[model samples]
Target chain A: MPLGLNFTQIFLHLFNFLLLFAILYFLLYKPVKNFMVHRQEVYRKEAEETSQNLEKSEKARAEYEEKLAQADREIAGLKAKSGEEAQAHYDRQVKAAKDEAEKILRDAREEAERQKAAIVQEAQKDISDLVTDAAEKLALHQSSQENFEKFLDTVEAGRAEAKN
Target chain B: MSKKQQRKMTVIFVVIGVLLLAGIFLTAGASAQEEDIVTVIRDAVIHDTNKIALFGLEVNPGLISGLAVTGILTVFALIVRIFVIPKFTLVPGRFQMILETMVGYFSGLAEDSSPHKNRLLSAYIFAAGLYIFTGTMLELFGIQVVTTAGHSVALPAPLSDINGAIMMGCTSYLFIVVGGILNNGLGGVKGALKEFSLPISMSFRLFGALVSGAIVTELVYYYTALSYVVPVLVGVLFTCLHALIQAYVLTMLVALFYGEVSEPSEKKLRKLAAKAQKTEVRTAEAA
Candidate 1:
């Protein structure tokens, strides 16, 4: 055969090469490729799950922070409102106490003045009675012994009347 | 010139002068009896056909060499499949890294050339690349076998036989045709048919490159004077270059042509245009 070119050799070479190709395809290429693809998919799935979990936690944290901030605002507002109410209540109570104290002092002063006036009227009446007695004694000096006895009897009757 | 350059030039000239003198002496010392150049050429070109009678059928020696290569490849593949591949981890070992790099290189070539048909094409290219690379480099081992005629001969690269190259070329063409049909239907068939000369060109290219290297190496060895240093240089350079370049060339051609033929045609364009129109209408309505 010129340069080893023959139908038989060509056909056999073709057959041998094809057989090798088939063996390699089945043995080496398929399995390694499948393994790589499967590993890639697994890694992708894991990454996705991790990312999703992170996002969920972030959202939950944000919601919690919002609620906490809202709570703080409400507590502050309530504190201010309550503080105003307490101050108003304190002012009203103080004003009421002051007015009541003033009323009590005025009533006490009036009662004390009435008692003083009554005492003074009684003293004046007593002073007028004593003065009349003194004048009667001076005018009765004509009958010495008889005038003295009459004055004594008159003093005793006045005392008895004052006592009654 | 600098001192260093002047010194380098002087050394180069001295080496050349010595080589020329040695050449003249060697030629003068050669025997007067001349060898037949035509006989040497014939011996270089022709491989002995040692036929095996398999069920009353004749088998060629080239085929025998092809079978040996195939057998070696099969056993290697089987070993890797059972022992090496199974033990492969996410972090590759040295041997595994070499295998992965080889597979990855061809796979990347397929993907870059034909993204749509990357799956099928990559597998095919990987198989083809391995076959060519291993088949060519197998000759470097210089394994010889005794034929039925009691004549011992060194096995040649499978592609050194024109039949093997033709087979590979035709097979690659078949893949390209199938890829086209699958991707673009009738248009793909027409496209593939237009490139009918592809198989012929591919076969001749592979066969010619490999045979030329063998012929040159044989010619170098045939000469007594030149055989010592020249055969080593020629054989190594030619074998390595052919093995690598032919493997890359065939795979690249297959991928490039497959990609060209398999690209989607009128129907895909229509679908794209329709989708764009629908989007436009929706946007207008929203506005």
Candidate 2:
């Protein structure tokens, strides 16, 4: 009694404490802690899910960006290729037109040369025939009017042959 | 002034003057009628007189207060478990915030002290801290019960009793020792045994600290003219301070000791983990 030390009271206190402990463990501590744990788990899962979604979107965006870049590069290559092809086609068409024009001019010049040669040969032949006829009329000593008339006829015939 | 108004004014003045005079006389009379300093100190230290007999053993008011603390805590827990717990949201409300702060503090303490295994330890400290805090705060209510001997007794903090303090100390020591033995075998027991004075020191610490605060509060109430207001402050603050300090000290000591003893044996830890994994696999297969 000096220090209020009693075995029975000590046991009662222990019992009372134990009872409170049990009650709190079951009713208060467990459930509240469980709720807190559950909430933490939920938030963690949500955070993880959000992170995964972000990662997926990031990957998709990167892939799309890569595809876009590739497409741009391909389009640039196609444009250059097409432009070169068009240039080549235009050069070919110009060359072909020039060759065709040179061919037409050369053909016209060749035909004119041939015609000049033919006219020259005919004039020479006519001149030769006229000279021969003049000599023969002088050697025969005929009248001057008759010789001149034959010369005129032979010159007219040669002129007509040259015209033809 | 009218005669009626004049009469009312005179009456009000007389009443105010009489109340002032009465207040002075009451304070003076209260200071004059003082009890013995030694007896007050003795009563503060030990409340063994007029003990109640339960199971043929005389029990102190501290024990009764202990019972009351337990009952009150049980009811509060039951209420929180039923009503408040169900309504708890991820984003906490006011009451939830308060509860979380209290519980989280103890849990964090447990985690700091016993890093290896803290779930059970946290629960333990939470219970112990709650009991101590609630028991010490019980005196604030000034709950009184009349005994068969025709004397009214005011219940006080449970640990004010030497027996109750001894109980707390021994319980905590036993808990730590048991934890050590269960976790680390004979080595933990040896470690626990080395701290043989822990129970006695813890018991006296709780008892002395609480008794000293009570004594000073009683001394202030007895010796001072301003006992009415001053003692209220001293009693409340001292009691409250002691409640928080003692609860923290006991739970902290237990956590430290339990943690030291209950650290898993290093050499056997791998084997235990492997065994646990095997069992888990077996269970999964069985399921």
Candidate 3:
């Protein structure tokens, strides 16, 4: 054969290759490929699981956050409500105390005014009596010093009685 | 091992190198007349000198070399299968990483090329890559064998022989056709047959690349003036590069064509049927 191109040798080479291919397929390629594919499947499953877990955690976190936010909003609302109630209560108490204090001052002032009016009336009566005695004394004893002195004594007696 | 020790070793290596060059030149002065360059080149290209008998038939030593490589690869596969593969963990060690990288690359290529159905494609490419790569690397070892006539023959790469290249190319084409048939049926066969030149091109490509490397290396070795360090570089460059490049090329071509032929025929068939129905309706409307 030209260039030593033997058909037998070519077939032999082909057989040799086919044989090698078969051996390597089972021994080398299959095992490695199967392992790699298996590993890939495993890694893919792991990644999927990781992503699923992440999604679950994210959902849970959002739920918790929502709950926490709702609780915070409730706490804020309760705090405002309690604060308004306390203010209302304090205002009512202050108004009641102010009314009580104003009433006490008004009663005391009114009682003082009544007492002054009574004193004024009694003094006016005593003064009127003294004036009448002085007029009579002046008329009976025309310019007598003893009558004037008697009028003075009577005025001093009235003042002393009023002080007592 | 230390910096200083390394420097000393470097100096010693340099001195040895210079001495060797001087020794070679001194000794090669009155060279024994060797075989003609043309004859050597022709023999290297033809695998004529590498003759051996196998099973009562005189055979080219490329067969022996191919068998030896196949045997070595098989034993390695067995060892790795038994010991290394069993110990493979999720987190890869260096050995596991190497195995994974090689296998992973081929698997990915197959999947990308033949997405519809890639198991057979994957196996074929992986096997083909391993074989071609090992076959190419066999030349570097310069393995020798004794024939029945007591002739010692240095085994070159199998693809350096025409028969091996033809087998590889034809086999790849055969796989491509098979993939087509398996996936696309008659339509797949049509697709594969369209690229009829693929086998011839692939065969010549592999053969030319490998034989060229072998021829060039042989040529360099035949000349005393250029053989010293040039041959090693040339041999390594050609052999290793050709091994890697050719292996990738052949596998890629096979996977690409196979994928093309083996594409989901259902999708194309449906589209064609729809187009035909539309044309029929249009013709009826015109009538």
Candidate 4:
């Protein structure tokens, strides 16, 4: 064959190569390619699952933080409310005590005034009675003193009659 | 001299003496030959004519070699599929790593060329690359078979035949056409038509490169004086280089052209642009 170029050989070579290509494509290329694709899909699915898990955990963490913040706000509000209520209660207790002390002072003053008035009244009555008894005793114990006191009274009466 | 240095020097002298004696014996054997040795440059061009009658049809020796290569590849693929692939883990083993590297390289090439149709093209390119590489390197084994002329001939690389190169080139062209059609319909076919000479050029290129190596190696072996050490060096270097280079060139061309044909049509691109412009105008008016 000149230059090894034979039409028949060329045709045969083409046929043989095509056959080989077909066989290899089916037997080797297709299966290996499918395996690689399957492995890639597995890796992608794993990555997607990991990403989803991360998202869920992040969402849960955010919710927990939000709840914690709300609890703190509530605690703060409760603390302020309790403080205000305690101050009001303290003020109410102090005002009530002051009113009770003023009432007690007024009651004591009234009682003392009543007792002093009663004691003064009793002393005045005793002094009048004692003075009356002293006059009666003097009249009984001294007859001359009595006569002189009567003569003085009669003379003083006759002079009064003459002048009338 | 010290004792140790003297002993070392004696050992060196003994080795040199033995080498000189062997050289003298070789020269004597060579001079004793009665007839001068002459190397005849046999026609080492690959031929498809010698028909091995397989079920009544004349078969080419190159075709037989191609079939043998196919068989070897099949067994290797099967072994990898059955034993090697199953053992592969997320962290790859050595064999698995090699396989992955090969697949990843081809797939990456396909992706770079044709992003949309990379999946369809990667398999064919990988198959073509493996075929070319193995077929070219197959000649290195020097497997001999008796021809129809009752002469023993070394099996040649399949691509050394013009027919095999044509087939591969045409097949790649076919893939380009199909890729275009799938991506762009009739427009894709029109795009693929532009590369009608691709197959012919590709075929000749592959055939020429491989045949040239064969021819050069044959010429080297033809001279008796240059035959012994030079032929082996020439043959191995040429074969390996052709195997790697031809495989890469063909696969690269196919991927590059296939990517070109599979792109979106100009009309479609224009429509998208117009739609985007309209949206922009409407938003501007609203603002």
Candidate 5:
């Protein structure tokens, strides 16, 4: 027959186990549990914060992208507007210079015509006066012989003066 | 549908088929031996240094194998490591910000536990605990697969074997070492030891409770001539309670120990940080 474990021995053994557990529970178990719970709570709080941060970052990213797009559009629009303004100013300046040149040419031509007309009139008047003076000297020489002689002397003298 | 989806579906099917085949093999093997797993656990407990009793009764081998203490710890560790830890970690797609937050929080924990704001010790403890628990549980479950798959492979005994004792001992030692290292980094070796004692008890207390619970369950079943259901139910209840209580207690003790260890060094560390901050401010002002 096997030496079976008696009921009393078994009972005592079990009781001893429980007593050990009770002691450990208080000394080790309770404290450890509390620590774990505290850690877990801390973890949960952290997790919540992390989730919020992630959401915030995502939102910030979206906003940034939107702002970037808006900035790009604004920059492009300004560039186009500035380019058009600059081209317009250049074109206006070129057109004004061309008109000024035409006006100056017209004024210069008119002034040259006026100076040429005055010179021609003066030359015609001088030519008529010289012709009349020459005719009068010839007529005086033909009037009388003695007077003609004197006139001839006068003509010769006039000739000598002209030569000198 | 698409090629990719088809490929995924095929992979899924292959995995399912493999799992089914493995399950069948395991069941066939188990049916052949039909030896109760609980018997092995009971014998193993008897061999351990911890002689725990429960409820004024000694439990049987059947209960021991069915409700093993180390096995429970392994399973819990696995679930937390594989499921909970990863969920908390949240890499790649979901909650990357959350992961960073967790990292920052643990970094703070490291600062609190150490004298010089070093996170090495705290991070190491967390990772080691996570890994140890995960590895042990996976090993246990992997052993179960063999048992069920018509394989003759036996489960590793937790007691009487040098390996088992070493593994369990190392686990406890790791907790102690981590605690000590954190304090040592902060307040020197002597202070580390003071802090290490808290975690040592944390690890040992669980083992004690588990052993006690198992022994008691066996005693009740055999001595009192109680109904089969009653013993099993009581054993399960006590075992769960013991595990829960141990986990909770260990956590609190470690946290409190952290607080205590960090207290003395506070003044010196604060002064150093303040001086550093002041220097930085002055430099900035000058610049």
Candidate 6:
């Protein structure tokens, strides 16, 4: 068996490597590790803050959205109620106007009918009085004419008696 | 003619003088105080590195520029008005009037924030806001907050990281305090605190908006390998858009906070009137 490395040489190389490792640990590895740890701490804190901020934003957004929706609902309900009320008001006004118009028309028709009946009754009474008067005048005239003719006959009889 | 009498009067006056001096000295000595007082000013400034990093805290150039300009202008204007204009006030100059008007305007703005109609609050707010804005802009020139491995990190440029934190903290604190005072005065102290919520949101909101816009714009520019002008234009446009959005949001929050306490009475009056009208209508119908 052929040994490529002597024991003393091997041990010396090992010691040299160990020294290098120690120096690297202090100069590069330790500092690097510390820096990385600090950076990580900062990162972790930042992540937590960001997450908290996101949560707050989400909560605020949800609250705002809820308020907006509630306002919309209130507005819609108000409009519907106002519309219903307006419609009711219009209907009531129309009904009152129609009733007033009907009442006025009925009153006018009644007055006209009464006036027409009074006029017809007055005409009939006037016509009947005129016919009665005419009949009385005719009767008087006939009686008077008969009496005059009788008087003329008497005068003729008296003259004949005196001559005898 | 009266030298002996004069001498006697002088002696009496001198005696009174000495007596008065002695009384003054006695009072002064009696009032003298010597006490060893150790006042501890606990300026406990609590800060979180993570919170600062998450917001990508940086210097603001616009704020810094605005402050420098405003300061220079104030000093120049003050010097000119106080010295130069006073020398020529006999002519009733336009410059004097202009100066007066400017002062009056600032005074009025100050009065709005003052506790008892004073200009101190206004002046303080203006100065602080200007300083904060300027410092923020200066910090923005180099400091950047970046996300790596799903965690945010504050990568400082030339300035130290602590300085960056302090700059951002100062800016946020200034805005919060001033806005709180104004809001509180307009509403109440509690309301002011409630109003402070707006600034708290703004602290992060402005940063978030700017960072997101920058990232997107940078990504687009990178992928497109756009020209210098293109990148600059995109960056400016992004910044402007972000600014407009931030302003709108801030305005909305202020208005909302103010409105919460102001609008209810008017609403109540309107409701009462409506109810009265309904009752009147009902009475008329019954009649």
User: Which model scores highest in TM-score?
Assistant: 3
Q: Which candidate has the highest DockQ of all? A: 3
Q: Report the Cα lDDT for residue B255, model 5.
A: 40
Residue A89: error of model 5 in Å?
A: 47
Q: Among these predicted structures, which one has the highest lDDT? A: 3
RMSD of each: 11.0, 9.3, 6.8, 11.6, 17.9, 33.7
Q: Which of candidates 3 and 6 reaches a greater DockQ?
A: 3
Candidate 1 residue spans exceeding 4 A from truth: A1-4, A71-164, B1-40, B43-61, B147-151, B223-232, B268-287
Clashes of each: 0, 0, 0, 0, 32, 11
What lDDT tens digits, residue by residue, belong to model 5 across residues B124-209?
A: 33433322232222222323312222433223222122222232333434444455455545353456465445433543454455
TM-score of 1: 0.67
* lDDT of model 4, residue A117: 64
Q: Look at candidate 3 and give me any clashing residue pairs.
A: none
1 versus 6: better DockQ goes to: 1
* For model 5 chain B, the run of ten residues with the poorest summed lDDT: B156-165
Provide the overall lDDT of each model, using Cα atoms, as 2-decimal numbers: 0.78, 0.81, 0.85, 0.75, 0.47, 0.44
Which stretches of candidate 6 lie above 4 Å from their native place? A1-4, A114-164, B1-287
DockQ of 4: 0.23
Kindly list the per-residue Cα lDDT of model 2 for residues B105-129, writing each as its tens digit: 8888988998987887888889889
Ten-residue segment with the worst summed lDDT in candidate 6 chain B? Answer: B37-46
DockQ of each: 0.38, 0.47, 0.69, 0.23, 0.02, 0.00
Reference-based TM-score of each model: 0.67, 0.75, 0.83, 0.66, 0.34, 0.26
RMSD of 5: 17.9
Candidate 4 lDDT, A12-122, residue by residue in tens: 666666666676666666666667788889999999999999999999999999999999999999999999999999999999998888888888788777876676555
- In candidate 5, position A39 carries an lDDT of 67
- When 1 and 4 are scored with TM-score, the better candidate is 1
lDDT per residue as tens, model 4, B161-231: 66677667777888899999999899999999998999888888988887777667656644444444566
Error of 2 at B216 (Å): 2.1
Between candidates 5 and 6, name the one with more favorable lDDT. Answer: 5
Q: 4 or 5: which has the higher lDDT?
A: 4
